[model samples]
Target: MSEGVVARLRQRLRHQADLGEVLAGGWTGLGPSELAVRPVYLEGSGTVPLGELFDLRGEPAGRIRFEGDLARADRLAAGLAEGEVIVEGSVGAQAGLGMAGGTLRIQGSAGPLAGAAGPAARRGMTGGELIIRGSAGAETGARMRRGLLAIGGQAEAYAGHAMIAGTILIFGDAGPDVGLWSKRGSVVALGAIEIPATYRYACTYRPAHLGLTLTRLRARYGLPVKKRHFAGRYHRYSGDLADLGKGEILEWTAE
Candidate 1:
């Protein structure tokens, strides 16, 4: 695979950036000026240009990779309608906000709202796969309408708040208030989790979906996949009593 222009530059924003507008320029064909142009934010103004910050290579080939640590990068993939975005290290808040399609993979931890909807938006992650190899901050999948969010590590509170439909898998212990006000969604907790009071305990059973989901997480992303996690029994609790009450929390149980 050929490298893109970002592989050749270091963006130290003279101002803030609107990644949405920056990436809008079709990645297929571009010159140095077009590729070097990225939006950044100033004190009170909007974003600035990429050339002012980073050094600016190839072109947008529908796939991009951030090689260095981007702990300060915010909205790394906001409103991304297509393509594959890879973050080599940790990311700031709203890492994949309002993504409609494509794949976002983070090798390290992600700040709050990793796959959450944008502010005032009605939905989040309408369609896509967000793989966080490390832990995720609070509201990791807030207001998710659809898509798959897999956290190989732990997740903070309010993980699936107000989810309409989707699947969230947490390999580590989930914090308090994990899923609240969800209409219809599945929260698969392979580790310890205390189901919300609104959720009523359903019969213990084995879900077939985990097998397919976990397999991809392991083979595609290099996440640890144990035999137990695949064939494990889960205690299903369904609710959101205050809402439509169609969502569920599946806590992996010892058979």
Candidate 2:
């Protein structure tokens, strides 16, 4: 593969910036100069060209990298339909909102609704992979229709709220009321979690799919996968009985 583009932040942001347009579809063919001219919205200052905030480098090869402390950058990779995006630091809310394809990898924490649908949209991420190496805020994958969401660290409340169909893997502690109102999907909890009352315990078994998914995560992302995780059994709970009741929560049991 050719060398992908890199955009390094010029300095710490003074106000939150909306970077939803930076790496959206059709960016893979654009050169560094063409891509840098795209617009971004700032909280108090309105719109400004991306070049003003980030120093663009390299050429687009179906991949992009952002190096910075973008804690105030919101919607960093929203509406992404293809290619690969890598963020080297923490990001603000709605990091991968409405993504359809490709991969969005964040090396640090993410704010609320990281992979969820926008207020006006009908669904969240429909396809692709969202990998967060650090913690994630509340409603991480709310209203998702499809895709894979993996969090390496803790996930706050409502991690997979109202999920339509998808898979969410949380490696650390999952906050209260997880998978609430989900219609069809899977929430895999590797650590502590409190299953909601709407869900009923089903059985403890070693799912064949679990091993396959865990193996891929370990090989591709370098996640901390242990022998226990590979051989351990999971307690399955089916729920959101209030909804379609097809959704499930799989809590890992120690060997």
Candidate 3:
């Protein structure tokens, strides 16, 4: 894919911005001028055109990159249906809330609920890929229905709470409730994790599918995938006996 627009922040934002409408449908066909007209909602302020905050350039390629600090920007790429969105720095809460299709890669950390549902919705992401290169705060993939949520660094508490389906890959330490109430999803942890009491220890075996997934993560994100993880054994624990209990947590081991 060709490189698309790069929206560099013009100034340090004093208030949080709701960039939910910045990448509306058909964004791939819009040039810099058209794209700059998109709306941005500022907290404690009012609405403003995207041009006021970001300097936009480049052709209408099917991808976009945001440069500079965006730690107070929320709902970015929310409900994204197509194209690729990349954030060079950390983002505020709900970074990719309820995205249906496409790719969202955050080069830096992310705040809470990166791929979780919105406030009014009960279900979270239905499809697509969410890649967080840095640490993620709590409930990173809450109530996810489908797609891949990968955290290259630490995942805070309740990492994959109530996921209906899909996969979560955590390369660093996982906090509490890795698979709290997931129904049929998979939580793959390559770092330290505390198994939940509700989960039943399943088995110790290497799943052949991991080679492909980990390889993709390594190649696509350069996430420091080690040699041992390619063919290593993982301890499986199935749980959330509190719910349907079909989900599983795969903990990688040195043995």
Cα TM-score of candidate 3: 0.97
Q: Count backbone overlaps in model 2.
A: 0
What does the lDDT read for residue 178 in candidate 1? Answer: 85
- Residue 126 lDDT in model 2? 94
Cα lDDT of model 1 overall?
0.78
Tens-digit per-residue lDDT, 99-192, candidate 3: 8888999999999999998889987888989999999999988999999999989999998899999999999999997889888899999999
TM-score computed on alpha carbons, candidate 2: 0.98
Measured by TM-score, the strongest candidate is: 2
Candidate 1, residues 1-255, lDDT tens digits: the string is 766445323744343344545444245355447756667544355566755545554465666666555665677787666777777788778887877777888989998998898888999788788999899999988989888999989999999998888999999989889889888888999888878898999889988887888888888888877889877788999978779999999999888
Error of 3 at 74 (Å): 0.7
In the range 89-113, model 2's lDDT, one tens digit per residue, is: 8999999998998889999999999
Which of the two, 2 or 3, has more TM-score?
A: 2
For each candidate in turn, the TM-score is: 0.89, 0.98, 0.97
Candidate 2: stretches off by over 4 Å: none
Which residue pairs of candidate 3 clash?
none
Best by lDDT: 2
lDDT: worst 10-residue window of model 1: 7-16
